[model samples]
Target: MTFTSHARVDTDRPARYLKQLCSHFDRKANSTFDEEKGRTDFEFGVCEFLVEQGALVLDLTAGDLDQLDKLEFVVGDHLERFGKKDGLAVNWKRD
Candidate 1:
């Protein structure tokens, strides 16, 4: 079975964060993104991003619970670092 998690990160600049994240991860993973949406394939799992008006939605999928948890932390931590000035937060719900 696959493990999954979702997070809606509130930020004033969703598009900017989305692009920033995709670009950063592209250096180490397979990432493709534009202004509205993006996807990244990491060694641990897959993360898909959607930029809304004032938030960035993240969907993460992995083969197991450990991978899912790792994916969530990695993505969320990077985003938090990137948006520290804006005080961004990523609260995830598992599925």
Candidate 2:
């Protein structure tokens, strides 16, 4: 099974930062973050774009993606304040 999550990008830096966080999660979870999974799935590539665009910055980690409980709310609040995204997405799948 595969799960998907969404994150609204407000700025470039924050989005790129979040992308990096996602890349780290992909490495940790041993999963591939396909473009279909998200519009931005690259690390340095996305970061470069964000940097060129001048984004504020927001790093969305895998842990903040836990939707089992109130993790979303907790993480959302922090990201909302830290990053330029309105909200975040947490995708998960069962094997």
Candidate 3:
């Protein structure tokens, strides 16, 4: 199943954050990114990110039903890393 959330981070360099994310997961998983295109994909149900609407739209697939909570943790952790944009809160909620 696929789980997803949109994090509102009004940063001028959203692509930069995406690059950092791709780099963070670099040796551990299969990841690819095209910052110029503002898109990134990661394997093993990690997450796929798209920079849009002043937010980092995220789609994460839980390999199994039991992985839902784990997926939330991963999402929450990463969103935190991206930090708040313009002091705007980063809220993770079901899409």
TM-score of 1: 0.98
Q: Which model scores highest in lDDT?
A: 1
Against the true structure, what is every candidate's RMSD?
0.6, 9.9, 3.3
Candidate 3 lDDT score at position 80: 68
Tens-digit lDDT track of model 3 for 1-95: 56554445566666777777777766566668786333334343566677765565665665664464566566557656566544434555555
Candidate 2, residues 1-95: lDDT per residue as tens digits? 22233334444345454455446545534323332233223222221112224333222333222432233343345445554353433232221
> All candidates' lDDT scores?
0.95, 0.35, 0.59
Looking at model 2, residue 12 earns an lDDT score of 39
Clashes of each: 0, 4, 0
Q: Which sections of candidate 1 miss by over 4 Å?
A: none
TM-score of each: 0.98, 0.29, 0.66
Sorted on lDDT, best first, the list reads: 1, 3, 2
